[model samples]
Target chain A: MRLELGKIFIKDVQFSDETRVENGILYINKEELLKEVSGDERLRSIDVELAKPGEEVRIIPVKDVIEPRVKVEGKGGIFPGFISKVDTVGSGRTHVLKGAAVVTTGKIVGFQEGIIDMTGEGAKYTPFSKTNNIVLVCEPVDNLPQHEHEEAVRMVGFKAACYLGRAGKNVEPDEIKVYETLPLLEQVNMYPHLPKVVYVYMLQSQGLLHDTYVYGVDAKKIIPTFIYPTEVFDGAIVSGNCVSACDKNPTYVHMNNPIIEDLYERHGKDINFIGCIITNENVYLADKERSSNYTAKLVEFLGADAAIISEEGFGNPDADLVMNCNKIEEKGIKTVLVTDEYAGRDGASQSLADSTPKGDAVVTAGNANELILLPPMKKIIGHVEAADIIAGGFAGSLREDGSIEAEIQVITGATSEVGFGYLSAKGF
Target chain B: MKLKPVILTNNPLTKSSLENKYSVLYKKEASLLDILMFARDYVHKGHRLLTHPLMGSIKPNQTPFKSVAVSKECFNDVDLLSLEIIEESILKAEQLIKSKKTPVYTDKVLEDFSLIDFDLIKNALN
Candidate 1:
């Protein structure tokens, strides 16, 4: 009988008739050990040799006893859903979820000792604070009111609004200011107003690489920022759960990825949220059908849990109506429309009512100002500790099935200050 | 060139800044030199900050010059990584330069590089 130990084998053990006393303890015979070792069938390859008494008692096995093991060889698999990676080492090696390769080098901490020593430094520098909570969100040009736009500029330290120029046209700073100054959002009467805080998006003139770049703003008076390139893995751009860019203004800056849960953790239940005004309308571009497809893809890409849209009768009525309905349905996001019901003798909403697939759509009535105040939103009634409020644009032109999408933007402002608002899309 | 080094403790001296934000033992502004001075005064009159029986202090001059040099060694690799970080950090610095051109500070345009921990690099290599 032979005994296997990992890759090693032992055999040729002496068999003692009985146990003997050695150094005040009883020592078992090698023959009994060999019998126990060969009991398993997996050890059949091992051949144990037993030695007689006075013959240097020893046990030996004939075969190597290496155990079989399994391991994944390469990066050949895909993760099914949103997974996050974090680096433990101070080096750039980051740990990916459901995978082995490090995602980044900056997040990792290198040595345990070094970490202990430097951990005090981070605390000394005031790494965390509560005064810098802020969130910035952008809206279309025509949606925001004039007064509110000026307020936005003063509050967030910049003007914000949609770009109303032709794609490819040079966007001057003055021209950008025009859209940025649209007073779009009405401050809700439920919270204390932080004079210098607002959330808005921006349309940078990237020349020809892409049309417009979008991002979530997390603080006020923060120098302009950029994200850690969100990966475009499988045709769709993957926005990481985090955002970067905090070196702008040292005094009033915040850093953290704008994932929903992170907002909850920092603010807990004491969140001050403002209402989101979505601009609702459907139009076209150089290629109407192609543009529609791109819009649909963007909706899916944003992946908001739910949204509210307003579609207006702006361009090609039939195509725009159908386009809105088709786009939102494709994204599979829950939607509610706050537009007027088209009044016909037959009680139908619009000419394309039959053509537009019916599901869950709301139709409104009255003048534009009346429509603005129509359908008082009950969701934003109580959670109004909002320091920032983001509004949307025209939404009546949508067909019965068309829907718009939006997100709840919350920022870890420059300290512990937080800005909460909603990001929405409508006019094209 | 000889390197100048400073050692800080969790303690704060009289009217230290850390006292405003955090609770601390001893003097917050107390440096290695201050600690030495306090020890000398204590030896003259039998007063001491540390009297735990098992604790002791080694003067800077009493320490072997080689040991003083040893402490400097701790920064060599860190300095190297800092250089690499500075080199790699150029792209972000350029971005900041570009962003500064705009009058308004946009959250979307700033780079949160402070979130990057450089200590991680040395720890990994070690």
Candidate 2:
């Protein structure tokens, strides 16, 4: 499949009378955007706010971050299954409102949510701090179950992103990037001399509240399967999990996956970017064994000489990561594993819960356990009081002086295993 | 049940949901470590560990509850892979638990953790 992504650069976002993009400014009619994302009875209230780069704003307990995109010409619309019909996507022109994102913030799973600081010492760790954010503070109606609340908030982010994406429909893009992944035989033949390289994509599908979707179906229900690299750019996969904020691949990262982009950049030159094999990280040992075995089979089936395996979340998924690495390596495929560390705060602890000597070529996305001091921002969105009980926080983590001392795990995309964030390691 | 007989868990939700279909050993006050250690003992006794001990994204120290699926029947020989995994998971859990900043969840938050812990193993119970 082939895709032409028209990039509409949005440098600034502000509430205006009309909702449109003009002169690189994304003007939002707050009322209209809310209406577009509202009507979910489970959500009692929805407030739209904007946080630009270098602002004194903090979005707490962020659920998911999504890039606003419109399918100018594609087999299917954006967010297939959730927002659009489940038609096969990944062929045609899609307009991306790049540099801007829709950030969903609330107490979905309470402690597992993330925080995004627009301008502060914390901003350096998260990629979202750089994006012009359209913040949705969604409050669930009383007595809403966690599952339903997660569903309601997840939809709001998708709907608002879709609504805002319409602004880039007719407007000409600042730049256009073309991404294509042809049939296996053709792609391999196109670069016959180059080494065949494939990507083993692991989705967080542990269970409810830690789920990912492919064509709107819970990924836990699907086995390891092949996917066109371009399909992901067209919104074929999305994050529905409220895993720890630091490493979860928010929908925006899926749309602009750096690994895919980098591989494509070297496509036809250094290596043959054959395809992507997506597998779920289930909570079952049998499922883990089955999925890893299937993943290895698919990698070997592609005749891939090498593979780059990336994981989402940590702990339980670390086992999945190791199993995939070992199985693929045993199949004679050189594997490069990308994951973040939960090493001790002093960086003097074992990195992964599981490991394989076969995992020789590994890329570390820094450590999630490293502590940081985030000076409180002047403006706060969502609940700030959640800091003390957050995943990376302890009792009294939120200081009375408005500053927070916690692990980078509380920061969104701080240690993104997909290599999406700024924090990573370099061998001395 | 595909692999059944024992659902070693601390979450009542998982036990209540699977008790009829499977033999559940529910421990109401069991910590994450306790549940894993019990699963290890069962593994040593020759019962197969069905699901991954570390199921949820919640770190062992972060969430107080855990539910492990183990086989009902026991053999004279223990599964080496099961033993290795349960050990590694326990080791990882221990490291995090000793990190010196464990979470102290309130009753409301504990309920959320209970559901999350249950959700992680619900599909694996099958």
Best by lDDT: 2
Q: Write the per-residue lDDT of candidate 1 for residues B27-52, one digit (tens) a residue.
A: 33443334434333333342212111
In model 2, residue pairs whose N, Cα or C atoms come closer than 3 Å (at least 3 residues apart or on different chains), thus clashing, are none
* Candidate 1 chain A worst ten-residue window by lDDT: A109-118
Model 1, C-alpha of B21: deviation from truth (Å): 73
> Residue A242's C-alpha lDDT in candidate 2?
90
Compute the interface RMSD for each candidate structure: 31.0, 1.2
Model 1: which docking level applies?
incorrect
TM per candidate comes to 0.19, 0.98
Per-candidate DockQ values are 0.01, 0.73
Candidate 2 shows a clash count of: 0
